[model samples]
Target chain A: MSELLSITATGLTKRFGDVTAVNDLSLNIHCGEIYGFLGLNGAGKTTTIRMLLGMIRPNTGSVSLFGIKVQPSQSSIWQRVGYMVETPHAYPDLTVRENLEITRRLRQMSATDAVEKIIGELGLMPYANRRARTLSLGNAQRLGLAKALIHHPDLLLLDEPANALDPAGIVEIRNLLRGLAENSGVTIFISSHILSEVARLATRIGIVHEGRLLKELNANELAEQEEQRLAVDVNDTVAALSALGKAGIAARLDGKNSLIITDKPTMQHPDKVATLLVEAGCPPTRLVVEQRDLESYFLGLVGMKEEKKQ
Target chain B: MIASVKAPDNIISKLVPALWVELKKVQRSKTLWMTALAFSLLIIISGLFMYILKDPEQARRLGILGAKAQIFGGSANWPSFFNLVLLMVSLGGLIIFGFIFVWIFGREFGDKTVYDILSLPTPRVTVVIAKIITAAYWSLALILLVFVLMLGLGAMLQLPEWSAATVWNGLGLLLGTGSLTVLICIPFGLVASFTRGYLPAVGCIFLVIILGQVISQLGNGQYFPWTIPMLYSGAAEALIGKVTAPLGLISYILVGLVGAISLVFTCGWWRYADQT
Candidate 1:
């Protein structure tokens, strides 16, 4: 199991003076798996990535890449791991090609044309000669991804990879990362505050809140866990409530002249709800069985966690 | 297939690529040209001083310009010109060389690109060494430029005492003093790393320059690393009138030791310190 995992972090905890940045976080991302590390700002996502890259030492526990211990002295491990933490930065004075060339040389990549190849692949050929400082925010993010993917490492850790990107660029990056994972079997541990973005790309999602992993689930499990509610509007709201009460059904008015039903049977059977409301002399005007989105689900989890703390 | 990078058995293999990257960055920056232009101005001013000394009567007839030239009071000859060049390099080297070191090390953090190189196949220590080597190369190149420009001005002015012995001695002193000053500026790299920016390291350079003057005045310059280059340049003897003793081997050893320790600390900070 350990051999099959590309990243294994056990009981990782990091504290900065009086503040505990990350607390008892553990994760195991398998090879070729796209793991979405979902967290809001200051949720220790960057801190955890730093620990995984051996950039910062954890107060307790350890991290390993390819089953080898992660330490600054373990220079060999970095060759297989590529990462971009936070907003990616490039040498502002150097051109896009020159910046990539420096990365190639420092990476000891013998292929001389690797810079051009990455540029073409990242659709940066038009801006190849332009200085990094002159490139737009989206182009800069592309350049960052290009540098990370230039060497094609097996494990790529990216923090907020879609930051400062337009909708088209975000989709381009999403497809690029998905292709890398699906075709090349690259294990990607991507951190982002955008849950919808991760929902569309990640196979497994881990929600981190207040320096702890609040939840971890696969796409299907996440969908199954989404809270479902049946919403119905009728001509007579008071009579609809009376009908539901007489029929021994749990329902309430949502303060907007609509009845909200959260019971599993009622939500699974909206037709029965409509028939019940219709027979009570209150015809249904509108009906909807709404499933909670990943964003609200994420916020709800965080809100619940905060509520527990309070 | 992912290509594997071999671990370096020696420093040279690791240093080559890192050095290449550092040199490319330095080559593309405007700071190099700005520093070069400043050196050219220094040489031109020295030439103007020599022009004034060549004819004291004509200089005095020019009013305030003549009086200001008198403050430079040395004879308009190759020996004096050589001493002037050495004096400029010795003091100027601290500001210029220290500036180069601070910028090379601090710009990464300043520009927020430090994270890019932190996790590469090349060791962080190799990168630190490469930056130091680049700073030294830049400082020496500036000194060489000053030496050649001074020679041109002296030849054009047709000053006397233009012997091979004087030129060679001047060349040796400029190179030696510049080299020592470059060596002394190594700690600023550590300072840049510690402060994580160029502004603080620039402040450190000014502090070192002022302290160098104060400690050299206190007559304990031979023991201070920062003051050794100034004293060895023979400038302190002329300017301060107190530093008369010739620099011994101990002074050279102290400079070398301080430089070596600073290099180690810079590398250690890169290797072990949490670059947050």
Candidate 2:
């Protein structure tokens, strides 16, 4: 209920007949923080976003925005919150400028030039006069973002906002969202399946799998927890294993015929492992330190790797 | 710091902007032009039928006339022409006006844009009301277009039996029938919202039309909300009894009641039901 907490949901659950879309979920997002909601398709990410936006009511529990309970009849709370639930959609026949203009009027912004300003900010000026149906998917996503940001809301909830964007467009949106949070104190709750995208932008990240939040971590903590390993290529595998074992370093051979050392000591000092291997008369052919990427880390966190194994 | 300005917390303050947005959307939709063209074509075809009926014997010699003139059912004059206009409004207005309501509400779901409008500074009820207002306004515009064309075409063909009183009475009947037809079509907005698409709403319209005809044949047309307008326009009085007997206060109340109930349901759905 604190004012500083822009979003608070407690025991939120939604059921569609027999299927539970969101189950016993609770989370808090503070102001000026970009909270990345990472989940696979149908992991209840969009459902949770819908609940937050009051598009769908929870079967149980509650959601409060800016310390006020969210309800469909409550209009004042929405003035400070902007959201794009799933895929961004606009009236296909309307031009980009006209679509943004509609949002401006509906948001009740007195500024007549708000549409033009958003167009320029989202780099949509080139296609401002073009019909939405005629734009490519990437441009359509930009128009959707433009509509959500037109009023410069204090809170933004975007669901898979970078769905159809190209690489550069994704980076552009990431920078835009990051800037909004840092410069304007906008609290953002963005959901995406792309771990690298969220890892790069989110101040705090929540991973949801199977209608449950598995873990929550800061960006720096996620970075520090990324798996690092010392890989060694030696002439003789038996001699290298014996040498590393004699040195009290646990080492195992990976599937690709390379010795993999994931223990903290050897991973911290690959040079020491190389010396041990050379002194044992097994000259090292390749000694390298490799870190696991965000995708692998995310897949591991969500138990997707275990599922894949089964 | 990002300055936050709260929207005024009143229905009137919310309605203006919501109505503006609804008007803009309607202006840009192709459905508006499509409906206008369909209605215009019906008026022009009715005028053409009247022109052909003016002189059947000479027209028979010209090979342009055929058994189609029999369908006119009466002499080619201002009275019959106005009656034809009334018939068209009562019959065709059901589909055309129903289509306007369907597009105004169904297009939000069809285009998958309902979520965008659900969580805005304007209340969801305001959005629903705005759509209803837009549908009514658009239906009225199309009705006016049909009336103007009927007048101009009647003049050009120079049909006989023209008088100021006839024109006034005919205009009044046509406007009354059009309003009644529009009123009944409001429920389709609820159907569209419930079905969440255009095809289902269109199916509902056709089903209502068929049921209205069947009910009228059963001699109970006056009591049916869909058939009351047709009966009031004298479309079904030949088969049924006097229009006034069946179309009592209860009948008008039924039509208004259907509209009121449908508006309540549509607004309630928008405000309470889940968008998914």
Candidate 3:
């Protein structure tokens, strides 16, 4: 209900006969924030995006964009919203430029050069005259982004924007999105299955599993939750464990060849552990600090790994 | 602040851009050209049949005439040729015109581009209206193409019974049948929208055509929307006049009512139904 919120959905629920696609979902995204919606496939990410764009209606709740309630008949609010849902699809027979032109005209923009500008911005010039059916998946994705961005709207709801892009293309889009948020103040709600991609770009991340948001964390909080451990490769693992234990720093054997220590003090000061090991005549051969990646963190939060552990 | 900008009050103002977009999409697709060619081929083939009927002895000598040529009623004239064209439109128009409606609406779902247009700055109703209007214009274009081709081919074949009044009457019936056929095909757009693809709509068209034939043969052609157009085109008179009644005012009203209801249903579906 807050006017300042750029996107708001309250008690949003959608059920298809016996299946509930999205359940009691609520989200509030503010201006200029890159909100990452992270979920596995069939986790209702696309369904939520569809609801937000008014492509599908929620059975039990309301969605508002820019403080105005969303209805299928409403158009003025859409002028300020740009969205790319699921895989971007254009008329296969139409050229990339023609596809963009159709979107520009449908959006009712008077500027004739908007299509040209977006084509250039998205690096679609090389394939501008090519039919969409002929383009590779990467180029097709670029075309989809071009259509969504042609009007330069204030809000963007992208579903897997990096689905088929190369590493460089993904980085370019990341930088472009960063610039859009920083310079133009565009509020972005991007959904992705790639945890690292979202971790690197989002200011806030919401992890959804089984149609429910399991957690919402900011950048600093996510970084803090990353599990850190001190790994040491000693000439004698038993001696190293004994040395660390005698020093009151608990360490366990890992992989039958290395010692893993999650003890706060030992992780904070690996040099002290090295000295203790050396004093015990079990000098370390290799020592390094390792942190859990975003992928593992996401999987751990979703209990995907717990099933594996069990 | 950007959200506060008011949309245009006039429907036409909002409709123009959407219409332009729809036309552009139609122009880019091969469906229009393909349909036009199909109708042209129908006209030319009908002309060839007339040519064979023109002189049975010559046609038989040339091996072009078959025993079925008797269906031409042993005549090759403007009146018969025009009636043949009317029948063609009444029958072929259901598929051709229905295909146009199906592709125009169903391609969005097939190409998976429905999501792109569903949340655009233009109202969904405007988009639907624009598509309907485009389909109307496109169907007219096809009808016009058939009309012109039939005239030129008829002239080239130099069939008998050429008169201004006859030609005018023929043209009137052909056009009236074509218009009614186009009006009835609007419901296919609703089928396409509801079913969200081309196959189901095409199936619906075939079902209606078959059902129309069966119902018309049962002596209730005037009561069915699909049969009414063919009845108005004089198909019943040519085939089974004794059983079919004259098409009444209620029949035309029924056609109009079906069209209006389908259009309203399609618009309502776009406006209120969940589009997953």
RMSD of each: 3.4, 3.2, 3.4
In model 3, the runs with Cα more than 4 Å from the true position are: A1-3, A231-260, A268-289, A306-310, B1-6, B62-64, B236-243
Off by over 4 Å in 2: A231-247, A251-260, A268-288, A306-310, B1-6, B62-65, B236-245
Candidate 1 vs candidate 3, TM-score winner: 1
Q: Give the Cα error of residue A62 in candidate 3, in Å.
A: 1.3
Query: Where does the lowest 10-residue lDDT sum fall in candidate 1 chain A?
Result: A301-310
Spell out the clash pairs found in candidate 2: none
Clashes of each: 0, 0, 0
lDDT of each: 0.87, 0.85, 0.86
Q: What tens-digit string does per-residue lDDT give for candidate 2 at A1-310?
A: 4779999999999999999999999999998999999998989999999999998899999999989999866777888888887778899999999999888888877778788988999999899999999999999999999988988989999999989999999989999999999999999999999888888999999999888888999988989877777778877898888988989988887644478888886688888887887889998888888876778778878776522110
Per-residue accuracy of model 1 over B1-276 as CA lDDT, tens digit each: 476444566769878999999999999999999999988888888888888889888788888987776665557888777766667777778998999999999999999999998888888888998999999999999989998899889889999989999888888888889999988999998999899999989999999889877886677888889888877878545532444557899999999998999998999999888756
lDDT per residue as tens, model 2, B134-175:
888888888789888999999999999999998888777777
Residue B176, candidate 2: C-alpha displacement in angstroms? 1.7
The per-prediction i-RMS, to one decimal, reads 1.7, 1.8, 2.8
Models 1 onward score TM values of 0.93, 0.92, 0.91
Better of 2 and 3 by DockQ: 2
> What's the DockQ of model 3?
0.56
Reference interface contacts recovered per candidate: 0.63, 0.68, 0.67
